[model samples]
Target: MPLYWHLLKAVPSLQIIAHRIVWSALLVAGWLLWKYGRGWLRQTLAIPRAGWMLALSGTLIAFNWGLYIWAVNAGHVVETSLGYFINPLLNVVLGVAVLHERLNRVQWTAVAIASGGVLWLTANYGSFPWIALALAASFGSYGLIRKLVAVPPVRGLGVESLYLVLPALALLLWGESHGDGGFVAHGAVPAWGWGAAALLVFGGVLTALPLIGFADAVRRIPFSLVGLLQYIAPTLQLLCGVLVLGEAFDRDRAIGFAFIWVALAIYAVDGLLRNRAAPALPG
Candidate 1:
């Protein structure tokens, strides 16, 4: 989270996003080589029948990163915060609309409350929180892609990033050769200092870790629980943005957030009831 905040503070969102995707690709590639060997890599990279879906997912992920970084750097942390809060609800909606998944009465109520919150925020701000909405959509779409792909998280990430790495590397090379490279060249904190470049690797590892944890959780826990915990990331972002980073928080934003929370609570209750009611699979 701080990585994103710091990056946005230092560079353009597109540049930061490009670096993130490139680094993630590299890190996952290394992991693939080590864990499953070249055979696994070959299998992972094997062009599948659904290659277009993977490509589209990559594009959506890129959009999510770019917008998020922009929001962070632009000091709209509050709105960025709201976006993540609403993400799970958005996902549920996607499940209903796109996948034709059924939501019970409780789930429906949660959606209504969340909808009300969004409307309240829009009414107050005189515009919808586009950043948050975009993030939710992008993330939801990425999830949909992953669902369609049905690969292990690590391997899936490897494949997705691998698809992206080629163009990313080409761009980096082109930028450097043309004297437009984004990397800093030299100094204590020198432009592209050893430490700075090193952070990219660390960033990749850091980025993958939480996702891995989440994946594990997904396997071990219920989806509703996973949905609730998803808020942790954005909540951290929101807190850091305001309390730690000292971004301003006004009454309207507070009210909007309050409404969103209420909606989420309603949504969570809905999910909990549905999960409890769900017929258990054979043990």
Candidate 2:
């Protein structure tokens, strides 16, 4: 994200998003084609429900990507980290509300604590943390939609990319014509030069690789483990925002974050205990 914020020095967030979509679409499409041949596309297109779900998820994730890019560049990295910190708890809420799932008392308590933290942030942290809420909402909704849809991660991402690619390409072309594009132009190189262009292009790999790896990891490991591991991202993001990027983390915000952190600790411990108590199936 910090790298993205740095890139924003040369490229606008919209263009970065467009490049991310276009190049990711091409890469994912190529990989799908190579591995599954043309039949995969046919098989995927046959699933109308999945397609619609992916479309909605794609839009939500696109909004998330754009918002995150803008927020980081706008010096709201700490708040962005807060969004991701809030995401897992929001997922718990969504599971109950949207999926009609049950939560244990401990889980409920965690949710309550996180909610209190958010409210405290809003009440005392100067302004309503809309950026954090929006990020959490957009990403939480995206995750929920993806979970409900029966699609493999890579293929799902491929379809989502396809849904956005046309407009992304159009946007890039428009930018290039207007001499505002960051990657390349008709005859002139981008003023930011080749390094930024390389990063812009590499953004596709950066976007797809982690998601693919994460999906594979989920398949191979216990989901509870994945849940526990999810904290690493926001933790590092918070560190980056505070230590690396030099963002403000005053006492009021620290208190608010402390509430959320305590909530997460409770949630994680409960999950671990529950997972351990459950009977293991024959391998």
Candidate 3:
């Protein structure tokens, strides 16, 4: 978030997103080529319904990335943190609704508590918490879609990057033509300097690695369990917003967040107890 805020000081969010997509496509392409040879693309393409599903997931993740970058740069890091905090519960809901995953009573209770927290925040928030809701919904849906699709992590991300790369390239080209590009300048003078340009390139690796890891994890674990673990990210994001970035965290917001945290704790404790009680598998 800090890196995005710094980069967006000199570059438009859309342009930054374009750079992310284009560079990520290059990185993923190279990885796919090296790891699976040239056959990976053909093999992925042969999967039933993979293309369209990945297309939808790609679009969703692009929107989520763009919104997060713009929100961070717009001095709404706290709200963005709230968005990610809410995402895990949303994932739990999605797991039950879309995947037909059954949740124990305690897990359901956690979801109810989280839902109440969101409602409380919305009702008293002075305005709709659209940023939080949108982020949670898009990302939760993205994870669900990725989980449903049969493609492997690297290849799924590769396909997603491929789907978005053309438009990203076009956006970059347009920005350059309009003298608003961040990576390169219209004249001799560079736009935003080479440092910013380098960061934009590095953004691809930052973007791709976590997503690949997430895709791999989502495939290996139950969707709701993945959601439970995701709190680690939002916890860090919240600290970054409140401590490092110095965003406001008043009483009302704190109360709402407290409710969500309590819910997460309940869900986590229930899972741990269930695991402890279950019989050990034969070694």
Candidate 4:
């Protein structure tokens, strides 16, 4: 992220993400080809079962990436933090709504308390926090879709990357037509420089690595424990937004965040007591 906006002065958010998908898809595809050869796509696709669901998951995850990059660069890092903060809670809602899953009283209480905080924040802000809501909803939906698919993490990502190839290519072409593409080999943008361009290419590897790790983590740990730990990312983002990015987070906003935090505490405790497992993300 620092490389894109701060150091390399990259192009628009869509372009940046498009480049990421291009490289990531290529990387994952190459690995799949070399490892699985003829059976690679066959094994990963698993149509009549997980195909449409994986495609939907792919779209949602890409949407999450593009929006997140936009939010960070648009100087809404704190709100981005807030979006991630509520992602797990949104997962709870999605599970119930989409998956027909049920919740216990503790979970219900947590949901109500979080809704109160979200409502309070929305009212206080006098407008819906679209960035936060978009982030949480997109990611939560992606997770839900991944839960329905039974592909391996790496292979699934490869297929998702496959699904995105056309759209990503189109975005890049559009950027080039407008003379706004920054990933060009002979451009003035810092990312166009050989060194920065190489790093930019490496972004694909960087992106997939975390998803791979997360896939492994969910497989090993209790879902509730995973829920307990998911806060680390958003918490750090919050601190970075407030301290590093210098976002305008005042007492009014803090009040809403406080409620959300309390709700998370209740949810986390409930998860610990229940020890339910969560589905792994396919990335």
TM-score of candidate 1 to 2 decimals? 0.83
Please give, for residues 1-283, the per-residue lDDT of candidate 2 as tens digits.
Answer: 5655555555777888898899888999999999999787668857758878889988998999899888888888888888887777777666677667677798788878878987888788688789989998888777777666667888888899999999999999999888778877622335557777888888898888876676556445433344446666887888898998899999988888889888889988998898899999999
TM per prediction? 0.83, 0.90, 0.95, 0.84
- What are the Cα lDDT values of the candidates? 0.68, 0.79, 0.86, 0.75
The Cα error of candidate 3 at residue 153, in Å, is 0.8
lDDT of model 3, residue 259: 90
Which residue runs does candidate 4 get wrong by more than 4 Å? 1-10, 100-102, 173-178, 185-192, 215-228, 270-283
User: For model 2, where is the 10-residue window of minimal lDDT?
Assistant: 219-228
The candidate with the higher lDDT, 3 or 4, is 3
What's the number of clashes in each of the models? 5, 0, 0, 0
Best by lDDT: 3
lDDT of 1 by residue, 252-281 (tens): 777867766776677666667767999999
Over 4 Å off, model 3: 2-4, 186-192
Clashing pairs in 4: none
- Per-residue lDDT of 116 in model 1: 79
Instruction: Give the root-mean-square deviation of each candidate in angstroms.
Output: 3.4, 2.7, 1.9, 4.9
